[model samples]
Structures are given as C-alpha cells and as structure tokens.
Target: MSAETPPGASFPESPDPDRTIEHRTPQPGQATANDAHTRQLPYGQAEELGFNAPDGTEGAPAKRGRGWLLAAISAIVVVILGGGGVWAFSQLSGGGTQPQEVLPGNAIAYVRLDLDPAANQKLALLTIARKFPGIKDSLSDDDPRKALFEAIKGDSPDLAKVDYAKDVEPWLGDRAGLAVLSSGAGKEPDVAAAVQVKDEAAARDGIAKLAPGDEYGLAFRDGYAILAKTQAAADGYAKAAPLSQNAQFSDDTSAVGEPGVMSFWMDLGELADMSGAAATAAPTALESIKDMRFAGALRFDGDYAELTGITRGGAANTLKGQPVKIAELPASTVGAISLSGLGDGFATQWPKIQQAAEATPDGQTITKSLEQFQQLYGISVPDDIVTLLGKSLTIALDQEGLDAQQPNVGAVLTTDPVKAQAVVTKLEALLAGSGTPLQLAKKPGDGQLVVASTQTYADKLGTKGTLGESESFKLAVPDADAANYAVYVDLDKLEPLYLSGLKGEEKSNVQVLRAIGLSGNYTDGTSMTLRVLFN
Candidate 1:
C-alpha cells in the first residue's frame, strides 16, 4: 500500500522506467552539447571528446583550466560534507563539552542550560496563551521567539550579523553551565560559566575574534571553555573536582532527577549564611536549617513542560508526617493545609529564635510579655506554649453565609486538651483588657482545639462537610498519609474572592487560575513535591 498522504496533498505517479536514456559518445560535427549536459558527462568521457575546448581541439590550456575547475569543486564539496558531519554529530550527542569540569569545588549552586532558555521561555508563554482562547488573541501577532531574537539584535548589532552555525556553534559547544561560588563574608557571590566546544584552540580563536580583550577571564580544559571574573578563579575551576564527583551535589541530584535539559543545585546552609550576611533581619528559621540541599530539573515533554525538585536537610526529620487529610475538606473549602510535627520544628529552632529575639527591640517586647504572663498566671510561657501545642495543625477556609462572600477560617490544633485549655484561658484573660475577645473551643470526640473568627463559624466546624472526601481534593492531595505536610488550594472557589480586585492585564491573568488547583506534599520530611491540577 502507498504511504498515507496528508489531507489536500496529492501523490505523483511513478516515472516511466523504459523512457530512461543510455549514455553514448557524441558523433564528430554534431552540434556541441549544452554546457550543462557537458558538465554532467564523466571526466574521462568529457576529456576524450575534447569538450573542455571551445572547438573540438585537444589543447593543453583547456585541459589545465578544466582540471583546476574540477579540483576546486571537489575541494569545496569535501569541506561542506566534513563540516556537515561534525555539526550533525554535535547535535545528536548533545555537544562534546563537559560543564562539570569548569565548575569549582566550592560552588554552592550550579545551573546547566541545555537549550536556548529565551526561545524555550517564549514557546512556553505561547503554549499557555493558546490553551486559553479568551487570552490567546490578546497575545502579540509577532512570534515571541522572533521578537526575542530581534530584541537581542537591537541590543547588539554586531551579534545580529554573526552566524550561529558557522561562527558560534562550532566553538560554543553542546551545553552551557553556570556556577555560583560563595565569596567569603562581605563579598558578593561569583558567577562562572562553562561552554562546551568542539576544539579548544579553534574556540579560543573564535572567542578572541568575537570579543577581543574582554575583561572576563577565560580558560580551556578538557572540552570546556570556562569564563569567570578572574583568571585565578577560572584556573582553579579547571583543576578542581567537578560537581559530578562532589558528595553533597550527588546527594541532592539523586533526590531530584539527574541533570537533564536544565538542572540546579542549592546548598541551603550556605544560602542561609549568605542571607544572614546580606540582611541583618534574616529569619531565625535559617539558623535551624542544617545541611539542606535543594535540586531540581526543568524538562520539556512535547507541548508541556515540567519542573520537579526535592528539598533535603537535617531539620527535615523533625518536620515529617501528615497529620490531617486535606482532601476531607468540603467542596466549598477554598484552601486547606495540614502540617505535622510543628512542635518539633519549632523546638528544634527555639534556640535560634531566642537569640534572634534577644537581639531585637520587638523581640524584647515579646520577652517582656512572656515575663508578665508568667507573673500573672504562674506559668512558664515558653514551656507552656510548646507543651500545649500539638504535633500537627490544620488551617482551612470554608464558605460562610448564603453568598459565600465571607470566608470562615478555622484552625484545628492537636494538643493535650487540659494544657490547651489552660493556655486558652490565660490568652483570653490577657486580651480581655484590650477590648478584643479570644475564644478557643474544643472539638467534640477529636479532643482537638478549634479557633475561628466568629463563634457561629466555630460551632459549625464539627458538622461541616469534610474536604478529604471530595473528588477534587482527593486527586490533588494524593497519598496524604505519606506526606509530612500538605496543602491544597481550590482555585475554583478561591479565584472569585480576589478576582474582582484585579484590573487590565492582571484581570486577564485570573482566567488562567480558573479551575486550577495546587497541592504540595512534604514527603518523609526529606523530599517535597508540588503538583498543579486543572479541571
């Protein structure tokens, strides 16, 4: 059977084989064949016929001229074929460069760009725009990819004339990588990049021609061309152990998928230290995070793209376990989140919190409040707060009244009922003189404490439909028991609450949020995942 042809396409019939001609020597005195036909004749046959001469004379001048022409054509063909092969091989093997070799051992974060990010990003935006017919027409008629290329050309006119295939690709290599190095205290982090190249010498010559006497340091090692702020740094990167062999990086990469397309690794502890140095008001939570590593990858699958990552740290263990099934919330629920081992997480970071609190004026005020509470209630505030709190807590929003305009926010805390009661009574008494009332009611049967903005809302908590049984919630928060912390947001119900406040382009963005659900799971305290669902 003939291969299927696309609609509106026609398949031409096979040519008549019997009509093909056989080659033969032309008779003397016959009209000279056309230049095109003479060129197609075999070199020996053409020579014997003296076709190289204007007349039928066998002259050395004509023979030499014809020989030189044939030699030049053959040379051109060889170069074209050889260069084409190299280009094809480079594309198929993802280039010959080793990005890891050009990154320093002390690199805190490493990022590899497998494809042209600008092009990919444009394509992603186009894909999203196409998915929503309401917004698709709002997009520019100009292709985003072409627009980006034009923008780049506008910024660098010289680059606009450069040929990527002949001038850049041969030297720029397969993949490009960037490494973030921790600069000692009081210094900015250093960024270094590596480009894979086909030939180090040729790449160097090309780079020199492209950007002569540029300030950036450059070095060649293995199949990579390294560029950094300093020559020393670039040299060190060339000699240092690559990220592939680095134990910490390997650990993080294992948790997330191996590096492909695009990948990144971040050291949380180092990042915390950097933050502390950069900002005096850095959060106390950063101090508790020990040996944390986060790694992820961005991969494209046909029209869709996925970003997957994992977080692992010493504090992860203290933050493990799913305490409540978020899917049990009612369909009217806009959002629900359950966090297990909250107490443990707080306790683990309590020392850091105390240090931070002692250093700040607001923290001093909180400390004074604790002292006053102790004096009045004869209770150790810190000990009581920790003891009275539960290992898990769940906060959820449910529609209130017939209009569903007001959200009835409720929090369920799992703690010792007797201790919770004591803490509640003291809190209520403390706020009594301030004119604001505080009430914490106990949920029947579950022994969990319930707090709501309104008493009517609190009263309905026990009788409200559970969100965990909802189909949308179930699909969003799959394997709730395996998660240490989980959160589900129902955009279907939540969008209307905030959509009215948005205008112009912001209002159009809300359309993308419709029927969208977001769910995240911190599984086994060692890894975390966030999944987005759309109806």
Candidate 2:
C-alpha cells in the first residue's frame, strides 16, 4: 500500500506530516514508497503464497510453512497501518465497540483508535488540551473525524485525491484498527485494516477511488470491512479466527482493567525478531522476554489524560518489585521516583538471570570480572550491592537539587540494619580510594538509610515532610500510598530549567503543563499508570 499510517500520542504510525503537501490525482505506476526504508512488494513470496494474480484474481492456497505467507503478509501490514490516525482514540466512560473484535486471533500487534469516544471522555480531554496551542489546532470546529481524515490524507500524496466527504464519510465508521496478523508459522507478518463501515457499498466505492479496487482484498464481517493487500489474503482473514475470541487477548484486556479510547498490543518476541540485526543474532536479544505481551490503553481522568500499560507472560515475573510509601518526603521535593522490594527481588532473581547470561558468548569474561571485583572490593556480586540499596528506595530532589554546579539530592533506603551496614562498610571501603566521597547514614526512626549530595540534606530527610500535601504532588500521584512504584515531577517548578530554550508560543505552550506523575505495581505481571497534568 502506498498510504502511510497516521501519527499521534505514542500512536505508532507514519512520519511527521507535511501540512504543505498539495492534493492531486494519484499516479498509476508502482506507488512511490513514502519512506526510504519501506520495501517494495516481495515478488517471490507473494506468488509462492498463491495470492491474487496481477489482474486481481485468486490463486490456489499454498500449504507451505507460515514463512512464505508471512513475508507477503508483512507487506499487507503496511496497509493495516495505512490510515494510522484514522483511529485517533477518545475516551471518557467505557463501553463502545473495540476494533479487536474484527482483527485476527493470531495478530502479532495492533494500534487502534476511536475517533468519537464517550461524551465525558471527549469533554475531559478538550478541556485541558485547549490550553495548549499545539493540540487546540487539531481540535477543529468541524467534525473531528472529518478533520482527522483531511490531516491523514495530507500526509501522503497517494491519498491526496480521495475526498473525505465523498469517499470516506459515507462508509467510514467510528472505529478503525490497524494490525499485523501472524499465521503461527514464525513467518513474516501480514497486515489488515478493519474499518467499521456504515455502508459497505459506499466503502467499496470509496476504496475504489483510493486504489483500483481489485488491487486490494476486501472481506466483510460483523459491521466492519476488512481491507488487505490481496483478495486471497482478505478472504483468508475473513474465515480466520478473530481477536475477540482469543483467550490470551481476553485475559490481557482484563488484566489491564478498563478499556480506553485508544490501545495498542504487541508480542515482544515477535517484534524483536523483525529487527534486521536481531533476526540474525545467535540467540536474539529479546530471547529472554520473547513471550511477553505488552499492552497499553489511554483515557481521560478528570483534568489529565492517563496512559496505563502492562507486560505479562514470558518472563514477566522479572518485573516483580514491591511498593513503598513516599508520603513522608519533604514538601519542597520537585521530583522523585520510588520503588520497593527490588533489592529482595534482585537477590531472588539474580541467579536465574545469571544462568541465562551464562549461556551467552561473554559468560566467562563476565565471570572473571565479577571474581576480580569481589576480591578487590571484598563484596559479593549482587548480594552486597543490593543489600546496600535495601528493599525500598526513593531517589528524590528538591529545588536545591536543580542547581547545575552543586545540587542537593538524596536517596532514601529502607533495609535490614545489620546486613545492610555490613554491605555499607564494604561500599565505603570501595569508595575510600576515590577523590569525591558521598554521605550515607541512617535516618532516625523509619529504619532508613540516606545517601546524599550533602550531609545537611541527608539530615533534612530524617524527619517527616509534607510532600503528600503539595498540590502538584497530590494531583500527579494521588495513588502514591497504594502504589508500589511512583514518579512525580513538578513541571511548573522546573519550568525555569528549560524556559531559556523555548520562545514566545513554544514557551507559552509549555507553561500550561503543571506536573507529571507515574505509578506502577507488580504482582504476577507489571502494570504502570502515567498522568500529565495541565494548569
């Protein structure tokens, strides 16, 4: 497909759109690839798979391995993602149809959008987004979907001639999803676009205007029209299992909790294999996490937009880290990220990681180095280091920490006193040879250890602080007490750091950002939530 996918809020798709590209009739030749990296059609794989003949008629199905079909399918994936922004999601309250219903059960990845979301969702987003000039321009006065279409087409000349009112509007539905489907063959990926269609005939007609209808494969299921690179591929997808019925997908959706306006899902292992060098690596870089599934959903929460994601299955347990309380930090804190149980988790899981690493080519070299380090520093590999860090830790900063020359910052650690002190002694010995020394001492009561830029700041952290009571801190990380891992930034307070880099409009646009917060937890799997608040 000549068309490129749309771009937006971590919504993976096309490149920076050229607002200056003028619309004209598409030329009739092998379509010019929008990007230099995009491969032209793979001829051998296409025919080997028995896809449609050049004139657009079906060929016999090939019973070969998933590989043959996979390569051809990879090409199909481009179209699946062709209308990237077509699915710009909006979310408020849940309960609209999701596009996963029409996607294949064996899909490797997908990015979907809901142009029109629950009313409350839209209202909430616009309310805050309007304060920023960049987003306000996209929130057009005309129908948003129509505005989105124009913007999408403007990104590529291949779609320049397709009018939104005449071609897309009549048949286009509210939801659209772009996806890459796998045939379970470990072969290349194929792509498809499930466009929710109001009128199939109108959709077919409109599609014809975009490309010679025969060049594309079309299939219908439920109320959506599935578009593919070939008629044969389209027909196969029509008969194949859909994601809605996939148990793994269902479980993941549940694990992530609520559905939002936009969401994305992908198989980490499969995606890694697609990388050119990784495909040829001896064991593959992501071999350890190949089976892990990563998914994210976006929605509006009062004054801010929240994005939540999770990594589950295949080595997901590696993410197991306990939560800790951060409400006691000083109210003057401008930034901090705190997490608990990692020291314990690290101790528990390091052996498994070491075993896996041993299988690599550099195993012996690593072993030798660790042996030397342990002998020289008189500290065990992970034991002493992690013990010194403790079970719970918070890396925090206040205004004083922002100074370029000599900043005031510190790390709060809650740990076992006797064992940690032993490790601390080892660390102190290790640092004794260095020119610059750090301050590390215990806090008064909370069984905490503080490592600071200055001993004064370390002393300052010994008592309870009002961080939890600060407005920006409260807004950014309200769930801190219940969260195991959290990060907060007072954007307003930090504005001066970057204000010199911005000018007029750019500076004004940034001023509206009040703060940012992120919180996450791990049980059997890891899930994280992030929010960016606007003033």
lDDT of each: 0.53, 0.63
lDDT of 1 by residue, 287-318 (tens): 44657788886533212333567777745455
Per-residue lDDT over 1-535 for candidate 2, one digit per residue giving the tens place of the 0 to 100 score:
1322112322222232321111212221112222344222211111110011111212222212222223223323222122121123322122345678877787878877655544334445445555666555444333445544443343444566778888878887767777886644445667887778889899878767655423668888778878787889878787788887878777776666544457788887767665443645545345656788888877654456678899887654644555566778888788888988788778877886787678779998888888998898889868776776677888988776685676768788787667766777677777876755544654534577776767778787766788898877776775677777899988888887998899986788889888899987787677788888878
Give the number of the best model, judged by TM-score: 2
lDDT of 2: 0.63
lDDT of 1 at 529: 45
TM-scores for candidates 1 onward, in order: 0.63, 0.73
Q: Which stretches in model 2 have alpha-carbon errors above 4 Å?
A: 1-97, 133-140, 155-157, 212-214, 239-241, 266-292, 312-320, 418-446
lDDT for predicted candidate 1 compared with the true structure: 0.53
